[model samples]
Target: MQPFPSQPLDHDSLHEECGVFGVIGVPEAANFVALGLHALQHRGQEAGGIVAYDPERGFNGAHRFGYVRDNFTKASLMETLPGALAIGHVRYSTAGSKAPVIRDVQPFFGELAMGGCAIAHNGNITNAAALRRELIERGSIFASGSDTECIIHLMARSIQTSIPERMKDALRRVEGAFSVIAMTRTKLIGVRDPLGVRPLVLGTLHDGAHVLASETCALDIIGAEFLREIEPGEMVVISGGEVASVRPFAPAQSRFCIFEHVYFSRPDSIIGGRSVYETRRQIGVELAREAPVEADMVCPVPDSGTPAAIGYSQESGIPYAMGIIRNQYMGRTFIEPTEQIRDMGVRLKLNVNRALVKGKRVVLVDDSVVRGTTSRKIKDMIIAAGAAEVHFRIASPPTAWPCFYGVDTPHRDKLLAAQMSPEEMRDWIGVDSLSFISLDGLYRAVGEAQGRDGACPQYCDACFSGDYPIPPSDQIANGGFDPEGPTTLSDHTAP
Candidate 1:
């Protein structure tokens, strides 16, 4: 077992989502997968579980209501969840309603119209309610309010001849984004939406074992070498210890979420062969090239901003120091039960190291600012710690629209940039000055195609540019933002 390091989670993460892992063709797949999921514990800490299958016992699982480390110890797992293939989940509810109820745990299983299957998914489905209605009319009974349940029903009732056929039908029918790992008595499958709005990777162990996960970090933890990224609209199936690929969707263009590099994915993990560390560093390099500042020291918010802070320091010749310390034990701000608590979440989430910033002219490097409340507090913390001056630099463009895929971005009016200019935001956050990387600069930071200027062709820039690939219908948005009733996919599901 790995040592657990506490981080004051973005207590006001203001959003929720999660990570997932699946391993096939290994004798002790669940054991290996548990370790892998632990590595990605930072992606989501709400709940975790692993489901394992063997031809003999079939579908055995161990689930719990806390962090992966809090449950499923190595000793306890030896007596349960023994199998050659497995799937795991770590959730931060982009859809599920609030409640620490264990029923919200994943690797949901049930008897299918054709047979039985178990699934754990990461991402949001925009058209789930519509799909649920369509399937409910066909006599489907759902156990969860999540859109993922809709996929389960669709898979069971599909007219396709094979399991992959049924999955493909379900995939084609769903809108929004999905990076799912599912299993049947005989098959293991992984899929991504056509837009690649979310991330999914395919990898292999030296023993010829196949693995699939939402982040490459999972594979790294379990000693699996990433084979390649699962292409958008592609599905990989493992049956009889052999792997097969299926590309059922037409050749639509790809739009890998660019934010993955900026905020998601562990810096140590690689996506599409690009190290997240290098990517964030590149963002720092670009930020420096686009907006250079005169300051005494460069400091990062904490955790996610450290690598970028190092990059900014390297590029700008500013000395970097550990200025902010995250209180690893805090829950996500978004996970906090009340709005007042969320607004104050950051104060408890991090502490300004007075020794590092006292009387120093500080340059603050962060990935991005959302509602600006969090950043505003960070500035307050720094000023209270005696910083002489503060300049803020963001690694990505300002988010102008809400994300339609899985990202739980804040609403339009709550956005700092929407209501105020950079100067205004600087004043609001109490920073001496603020400058954000340009869209062109952000593209360069991520290594966009040559000669393409700053646009990321394979990037989903809808949230920043208001260029939504598939805009949400008005009624859908109404239902989506609802915190009460069964308005949200999470609210309808078993929270």
Candidate 2:
């Protein structure tokens, strides 16, 4: 077995997966959709796609494996694309499937008895193996090894009377987090999984056009006024320029992943009607009220850690400084193709501002630390940069178990905090002091849990407290990444 933390977190407290944008309005819809997708490019830079529907041409899927700007141009889109309704997807593969290779591009296209179904998915499903087996047994063929493919197959096999009915029924059978945008011959539809583990928002343009996206930022770029989010466990169908919902698949509940506000969604966006930036600021205020620390300067780890650090500094009456500088051009360290490159990625990814950190007792505010390896290296770098003493504060709780839904976290041993005591973890990370935000305090930081109903609450705290909102596969099996298989162009090395 590989050495790994039993569980890891999926949300980094910054940068979310791909965004989906669709327009069901006018003839220029394809062009407007492309422009909206450009706004969502940050969610996934590795790939971009837009599938436009034309009655004369059926459904056309255009994909490129690169940044949106580089892959598409107004001229190319104008020349090759034409339609009144189009759906687009940007991608960040949680699995190693994501790559610069053209074959790895998304808006996965497939033709079924029900007509053309182009699916763009965000988040992972834990029960995918079981569902895949069920489909394979029923004689459905699959093209890719992605969990997203499982959904296409399921939708094809459902005995529902209509395509939309079959799609919703297919979703009912799958378990885990998912928010998907599916484009059909004459419709653009959005579906969020039962728990609403992922987010999907709806909007409309001035010309009576309906738009759907993962975040409001995408809508903003395309000038679509915000509508409402596709309700959790609900399906919104847009056909013939009309929008309506399928029955709520699961009981309406707010199991929205809390991590989104802390790290994933951009601060400028509003999630579930609340400002993420303001939420993070409130978190900082709460963290200060609950766990105050004295230090010469409060410095965040950079990017995700910045806003919270500002809040902490402001509430604690300490000065806030930009103690760390990120190498903005550094590609994903996890995506580095070689170990040597991965090591260099860490060094080049973040550089401490010696002038800000040196000779000062610094308070380090980081979103969360995964396997202790990265934090240890970060600590060494800061010390080398000449900080007098470094104290670490995790804005979230420790991750002790792997997440089965969407996050690639597998196994428990890789987590530094799994079996070790706080002091042991602190020593392991080589920090002067360490403390994670308390679990209760963490919920209070979000402040949306207004009730405690039977069983569970509105949020998913499984990764932190070992209480899964849903059950994992109980089959007695032990296997993972087939190391002998032909390697694809990806980065699936140690996390």
Candidate 3:
């Protein structure tokens, strides 16, 4: 048992997605995984778990509720997880219960006929409900509410004789986005689903140990050299310091999530060989070209909005100032959990730079406006701080639909863009003007020269375009679930 961190203050932003990390052929592998997960803490703050295997100890696991730093950093706990092969997961519960529980924490372990195998997964399983029902009827007992447990149960029921073979069999029967890292007594494995909706990469340490993580930033923290991205539909297994590749799923078009480049990933990380920071900065450039506005100064919402704001300032030749200052020390602020207190989060987390924006026409740049609640509050704060005008420039296209693959999002009706046009949103938020980068412009910024291909999109822009590359099986199975109802896949199934 462990202490659960304070619940994050509710705000208009996408929930943090999960992150996975693994290492093989290294001493104190769990320690390395801890550092990697620390770098990925931004992706998930709810809970974390790690599983390691040693010759004598076999499989040792630790599951805790809260940030990796608060739990995994303790030497007393890390000592018990001694092994040369380890894998870990940081979770935000897109596919499980919202309330914190050790059972829902991941790097789920199972004792197979071949050996004890552990798996850590990033991304959601769309078909988890049906799979879980079938498994339960077949007498499989579930230990956690996470959809990731479906894969473990499938592996357990596989007819294959080897762990990797069993994993292949299990994944073949599954559908939806996944980038998985798994471990056996002698091997470390990584696999990305055919569409590649989530990011995963391979890295190598100086001592020749291989690392697999959801993002390159995790690799950076462990001083691992990124070898390459694990390709879509490809599975790589590392044993005895050697890596082998196999394609377990049929080849399909790649649809990596474009949101990773927009807001989910750390700007310092790389995706598809392009720098995420550079892409966001380029997004600002595109936004400027599409919606040039006359303003005294351009300001960012701060933190996530900084890079794009810099690019906007550079492209438009407008003097950029710190119009809004963020309180960097603030972590979770829902200790009171009052509705009024929740509404005060924007003020507590951010403050307008009164001296900088006293009477200036300030253009406020932010990644995206989800519910418009936070944006409205920010605009009011700027107005109260004496800003003459407030314009909002969103770096990504308007989020019109909820994401089904890993990202935690509200239902269709709750989304601001889904209900109102940009002009209406501007009026509702009381901003002087509001604009979001065009879908094609976002594609161009991310290196798609001519723009997004309508028939075969280069990336998954489902949240923006409402074009899901993979059919959400369970949602469809739910008889095209009511738009007004709770929308998360987990909400429709048993936890």
Each model's C-alpha lDDT?
0.76, 0.72, 0.87
Predicted model with the maximum TM-score: 3
User: Which 10 residues in a row give candidate 3 its minimum summed lDDT?
Assistant: 486-495
Candidate 2 segments exceeding 4 Å error:
1-17, 95-104, 333-342, 449-455, 474-495
Per-residue CA lDDT of candidate 3, range 383-469, in tens? 999999999999988898888789988777678898889998999889999999999999999999999998678888889977777
Taking the tens digit of each residue's C-alpha lDDT, what string does model 1 give over 65-173?
Answer: 6677767666766457878888998877653356656666788876666666788888878777778777888898877666677777888878887767888888777
Off by over 4 Å in 3: 1-9, 95-98, 337-340, 480-495
Q: Candidate 2 at 312: error in angstroms?
A: 0.6
Q: Model 1 reaches what TM-score against the true structure?
A: 0.89
- Backbone clashes in candidate 2 total 15
> Would you give me the overall lDDT of model 3?
0.87
Question: What is the Cα-based lDDT of residue 343 in candidate 1?
Answer: 55
State TM-scores per candidate: 0.89, 0.87, 0.94
The better candidate by lDDT, 1 or 2, is 1
